[model samples]
Target: MERKYFDCLIQAIDLINDGIHIVDRSGKIVYYNAAAKRLDEIDVDKAIGRHILEVYPSLTFDTSTLIKVLNTGNPIFNIEQNFINYKGDKISTINSTLPIIYNNKIVGAMEVSRNITEVRVLSEKIINLQRELYETNNTSVEKIKKPKAHYTFIDIIGQSKEMLKLKTLGLKAAMSDSPVMVCGNTGTGKELFVQSIHNSSNRKNKPFIAQNCAALPSNLLESILFGSVKGSFTGAENRPGLFELANNGTLFLDEINSMPLELQAKLLRVLQDGRIRRVGSSNTIDVDVRIISAINIDLNEVIESKQLRQDLFYRLNVITLIIPDLSKRKEDISILIDYFIKKYNDKCKKFFNGVSKEVLDIFMDYSWPGNVRELEHAIESAISLYDGDIIREEHLPFQFKNFHPTKNFTLDTNVIQPLNTAVEKVEKEIITSALEQTDYNISKAAKIINVPRQTLQYKIKKLDIPFK
Candidate 1:
């Protein structure tokens, strides 16, 4: 290529967020962008013209994607590769390598790699957190202080038809020992459902532990789930994992989709045999722990994305509960508002009697992406901000004050639809329009529509609203 064209190409590739690496047919590094250098921890001046294997000693001709593509004249798309650099620092990446052919002759290979080192680090930290949360000695369980479960089915606030159906299913599931999976958007009271089930289950008196899977990584998560032996690794002590700690009780895994795929396979094994093998132990121990898992996203989407293992999903999904969005249960919003007003009234020592009609209309029209959690926060915000007995529109958050309906739809006069059907259609259209306006930014869209972000998120999930 010409010098200006080459420079232009370099600048264009440099603009990309992911690493770009290119090598000649001879496996000599020809191009390495700044992103590639940063991701691979290599110097651009030194890497260009050097052999691929020379720069990354950990990779061989057989293992290197660039070399494989160059020799085979075949592309390797979206494959995860892990290697250590010359400095012995481990790097993980998802790479797409393609052969650069000229005149039907393989001339070189180009690789696009995205670094996932932070994900690995995050997972490791999560494992450590799990160990701390479920700390236990080999002989006895560690006494980490945990709050007692205060809310049961009675505490589950909504009484809408959908809510009633969900509660009925939850109560029935609580009677059994099978794994349960609860799916809903954020702030949909997933923990409340899990707590209610635990409180109602036969294992209510026993330990009822809950942990968010996103908080830890796979290796540490594994050690925390299935106890670790003293010599499992350096500083590894005889610690009982969550499974052992919650034996004959309930273990609630929140955001279960966040658990690593490989670790999920192990979880499936444990569920199958009612047995758990410590991180580095040979013997298997039996633990009759009822598992309850929750996910903020659609389970099908998670499974398709390979975040949640299919078999494990099926196991946990033997009994599944899909929580309704706040929009679908709008009837409960007034009740919830009243309940929260009383709640914050006592906590903040205020005498707020109710919300103004204008505020109520805004609440009804708003799409709560954050669901109940968001609603509670909105009420609390208004209560804390206002001194008067009534919560006026001015006391509401800026999101509500600046709220604007994105669109208005009119049903064809020639066609008549049922009142309920027509109302649902309008609701769906309004939400869909807002999502498009904000490019599907739940928080922004929620604010635009004067509802909590979680409530809006729940509506999206419940209404099957799709966005990129």
Candidate 2:
């Protein structure tokens, strides 16, 4: 080629954004474009005599294939790998190389490449989305539109007659498309029923999200259950809420009785309308989310007293389920004890064959105010302490160690414990169990308990539970 034509070609090469490299059949650098040279900080004018690998050590790879391409006088496409340039910035690229054949003999390999860093990044994002889709299906956590309960029907480990009845109802509820109201005392695993309903539902393929209606402030809760548009409020990121996110799925609203009257009305509207508008926007986005609500408080009182809207109560009570307290389900204690033993055996790296009969007797006799969740934590704690496969009474936490099954056998006496003492006991149980489960992260503990950071801090102070 003439010098003028070569200069014109160089100008054309300079216009390309992606790197380009040209190597002669002798494996020496012949024509590396401005972009390609920029990638390696190599001056093409001074690079004419050097071998491709000698110039860029990072570009050196399986050369047998390249040699084959050259020897066969053919083109190769999409040679893929990670590339670290002269500046040490990692880049991903796909190289398409063609042998610039002359008189049927390969003279050089002209390689064109596109930086696939963004493409790879986009591909990773797609993989994450797919994982989120599949992982949500596989995890032990209940599928929900909110952040209420982590457990589902399977996670509720018990074989008592009462538990079996609850399970039957839960499975039947899961098969139905109607709204389900789960009633239980605080920490009684009402949310578990909600999750079981969702996991077993027809829409299990979609997301299962949950939220505590009474947890967030009315405005924040409204925005969370519905959604808020961009510029809806100061510093708002314009995110969609549970209703839109749970479309084609289930939404578990925990502590439903605690929901404010105004939001209860809004919820009733969504239940009837099947559509949600952003907090400050008028555009109504339709949704198809099943409702599975749980309440620690009595809904009858809530509705009768007008604390909760009567109309909303009637609407949501299409298929109501009253979860029996742990005290009433003594039949399932041994099964649950063994289940948690097996669970924490792997988690705590301890070989716990099973709970001692002594431990099982105490567990069966104890009136669990906190229900299945409390038992799970108790067993987890026992596993952490007990070195042997058999979980003895000594391996149990301090409270359980001194806990006499006959101490609070009466419901009247059990229901009247001092709030401060009760809080301390619950806090100790939750903290010790959380540590045993996560090896102790205060942040994770706070998250599991679903308390505010400051609230958790206060609880830690009040309980005198050291967070290590």
Candidate 3:
């Protein structure tokens, strides 16, 4: 009894967190642990002192795995096997094998395993969320206001051909005193280009001011651009306008096409004559401010519609620079992807291995309507949703399945078909079928039509199609 007690105490010294097992030279299981037989419903006492292969004769179970690690003097990790249970169902498990060394002699080896079935299931969910986020941001990328930053010309990234072309035009425009007009799709970094021009010009040291003409009321905009004398209507205070502050520098106007028609006439005079009159003041202020205006919408169309003054359009459009959309610049996507990934990773204080090839392939496929701004947010969201050390296909957001930028260069198939008089035509046939399916409720009918509610209402009014 005392001898058996001493043996148990000696064996207890070799116990470890990881499961341990010992086999004799003849391959007999002399000792094993409760943890070793954890997967099976077998009794640990019965599992002990049995032939290793005969003990757990499950499918794909290898007796030689531990022997191999023992002989190699190295550890084997993450070996996968579908172990058939007593009821004959496969259970996923990952095993780690390590050699046991005793006084410079190879004894036996032990194996440890962990179940990863739950983790695989969770990864599927994270991938789906990643896709949903990408789709949600795609439609609203431009409408959201970006966080204000103190970035200047140097902060603008890229030396790509498209950006360099804009830079050359900007440099030339900045050298001259002509009013500059920058045209681009919304969120194409128009402000960055404007600041670049200002930084390159001789007026680099002076104050550079920027404002969106479309974002403010006309009365407030007038005071902001042309200054306001004391007692100039409500919130009256003596203050310098953008023209005064930007004297010897540049004043950048964003969405200039949205500037009210009445204000455009006043802006035209300021451009024609380098003089501006303060509100409620008779004296004209002599300011040498350079003018730079940006518009996503074509000002010529606004001029034709009489929404903008023709004279003001011509004056501001003297030197025009059109920024190509992100879809047009496919070569820059990879560089920009890495840039934003690194940016957000540092800002969020998370570590993510680079995106998998599958994810990169999807990114290359998407048509970016919202331009660079859209791409940046998509990358940020992907990184936030990624689970593993690396971002994979599951890590990427959706819309990539159908996204093709090169295909977007061609004619858009989703184009609205003009009014169809006959019910036999495609548009008419589809709409009538949708309306019939919806039972003729206009609200429900418009959703069934897959067209905008406002558009469907206009079509109904135009075609005299009755809907309850």
Candidate 4:
């Protein structure tokens, strides 16, 4: 190479993030880039012309790949090495060394190294997480009790007829070892119900693991649900999946509809045979795990969309429990509001009277698309902001204001009736309007009319309202 071109090449090499070093056949330093100086914590002034052994006294012919490559006139690749740098800071690297030959004679050697300290640290963290998950499954601890169960049936708070019926069915399902599939809209406390069922089950003493299927990609979800062996993928390590970890316990897979269709077929096989094959292993392991899966969308819709397999749906839907959305159980709103108020009052160290009538009216009127979780957040935010005795309309979230039901009643100009009869007619029209707007969902209609669900149901029956 020409001298100017050689300088340009060196400048290009200096721009690389990896450490680069070159030495003559005898191991005297010939070229070192800025990355090499930074990685080694070396002073460029002292290192430029120094012998390799003089600069790094810790490296010997036996320990240094550059020396070995020069002696043998052969190339070495991807050898991990650790040693103290120029500043005595511990350095770790994955290194590659190659001998430079000219005219069939060794003239020099070049070395490229990449820092892997952070990578190794991250690998160790993953190993620890996997290890903890495995230990919780395999070893029984006599002294240190397992991590406390997060939730139980008693923790589920609801009083609406639909909620009560679901809870009763949930408790029944908990007693059996059959697979349970929970269906509910997002934020309607599906996970809460799953956790409660796990705690109330015969396998309560065993591990209870919950994973959201939608949280990961298909390949990763497969590896997480079914254990993986080393070399399964590029950097995979041998690890047990949730199926093995939840053996003799409960495995709750949330948003199961989000899982890939192909994986759903494999899951069906597991459900059928109670056997799981790891990602890279041929052997099948028997797992006595009670599977409880949840989905926010309707199963029929999921099947039609091909998001879930028909065979898999049948296998999991053995003990299907459909949890009604918050709008379908408006009677529970007051009880839930009180529960949340007390919870936040204790958490924030504030004692405020319950929500004002206007605030409650707005809350009842607003359709909670985010369901219980949204309601809880709204109450928490109001409690945090309000310093007064009661949560007022101002404390309510902005969405509530936008969702408040209109009270305007438009009468037909062609119709004329007696005063009492007209009053009843207008009342029936308002009731019918509320029901229609809420899709005949009585709980939502009650909230819209600022009445309890039971009261709305009674009025619907008494007025002979034409609703489906």
Top candidate by TM-score:
1
TM-scores of the candidates in the order shown = 0.67, 0.54, 0.53, 0.63
Q: For model 2, what is the error of residue 426's alpha carbon versus the real structure, in angstroms, after optimal superposition?
A: 32
Ranked candidates (lDDT, high to low): 1, 4, 2, 3
Name the lDDT value of residue 226 in candidate 3. 80
Best by lDDT: 1
**Model 3 weakest 10-residue run by lDDT:** 402-411
1-468 per-residue lDDT for model 2 (tens digits): 999999998899888988887788887887778887766676888777777667655554454334446667777765554455566666656567788888977888877877656654443344344335433455567553333235568787777777778888889988889999898887677766787777777877677776766633465566667767765543234666777767777888877878877778888887898888888798999988888888787766777677667888889889989888777878777777777777888788887788777777777765565778888888887777658768788877665655543322223455888877766676677666655444465665565556777887786777787777
- lDDT of the structure predicted as candidate 3: 0.65
* Candidate 1 structure quality by residue, lDDT tens digits, 361-388: 8788777878899999999998887799
What's the lDDT for all of these models? Answer: 0.82, 0.71, 0.65, 0.80
Model 2 ranges off by over 4 Å = 1-154, 405-468
| Tens-digit lDDT string for candidate 4 (1-468) | 899999998889999999999999789998888998888778778787788888887677787878889998889876666566656665657789999989999999999998865654454355456447545444565422464258877788898788888889999999999889999888888887888888888787777777778734455667778877876543456878878877888888888988877788888889889999998799999999889999999867988898888888888889988988787888889999999999999999888779888778767766777999999999899888878779887887766643445467877768877888777788798888777656677877787668988888887788888878
**Model 4 segments more than 4 A misplaced:** 1-144, 408-468
